[model samples]
Target: MASTRPLLLLVLCSLALADAHFKVFNLRGSSLSSSILGHADAYVKVFCGSATLGETSVRNNNPNPWWEEEFTHFKAQQNDVLRLEVHDSDFGFDDFLGVCQRQIKLGTNSHDCFLEKGGTLHYTYTLG
Candidate 1:
């Protein structure tokens, strides 16, 4: 079966060459943030129409750090709905580094709701 992580990465890489419709963020390293470097715990949910395609948590190595969750191979599909949501309500306001550009995928409804202003997250997906 086609892996989800590789697929998402491919979509993200292509987004760079296209014209940005929304202009989510300019490529720049932001200054120091006020939040305490908060981390966002997110999961991947795949859906198509009203049916749930699948769901998987971004596995982690250490729970305390919570920033190094490797998303190299996400489990997803073409018509599935994917949502990366902060799992912990408490960590929403904690210190957070901008998401790694290498790990972003601009799929349908793909977006990163970075708290405050430190990183930019957006995606453009073309479904078949």
Candidate 2:
């Protein structure tokens, strides 16, 4: 029937434009800003647009930290912007170290984002 044909076409189109899987891994930071007390207790928050994908655990008393953690988003779209924010955690208030944003791309990608205060954030991502 004509109605059935249109429904089938819509389903096919939806499948063709289905969301992608995005993976973030191999996160590290070097020469980060130091806290007022001493070395920074750093952590990273990953986001896909306004939605939070994941966050790394805080590394205490470390200006340079490497996180052996991975985060994934199963419903990511190619047009989505991936945002990363680095913070230094404190007992009273967390300090904002820096932030980076990248447009989603197919395949594997890497970036070394420099923070606003100081330091470099190294990270890798894969989209499929």
Q: Who wins the lDDT comparison?
A: 2
Every model's TM-score: 0.26, 0.86
Residues 40-106 of candidate 1: C-alpha lDDT, one tens digit per residue: 3333333333344343444232222223222222232333333332232233342333332222234
What C-alpha lDDT, on a 0 to 100 scale, does residue 22 get in candidate 2? Answer: 85
- For model 1, the stretches where C-alpha displacement exceeds 4 angstroms are 1-38, 59-86, 89-121
- Give lDDT: candidate 2, residue 24: 93
The residue-by-residue lDDT of candidate 2 on 1-128, one tens digit each, is 25688889999988755787789999999999986688889999999866898899999999889998899988888878999999999888899999999998888999999999899999999988
Pairs that collide in candidate 2 are none
**What local lDDT score does residue 40 receive in model 1, on the 0 to 100 scale?**
34
Question: Using TM-score as the measure, which candidate wins?
Answer: 2
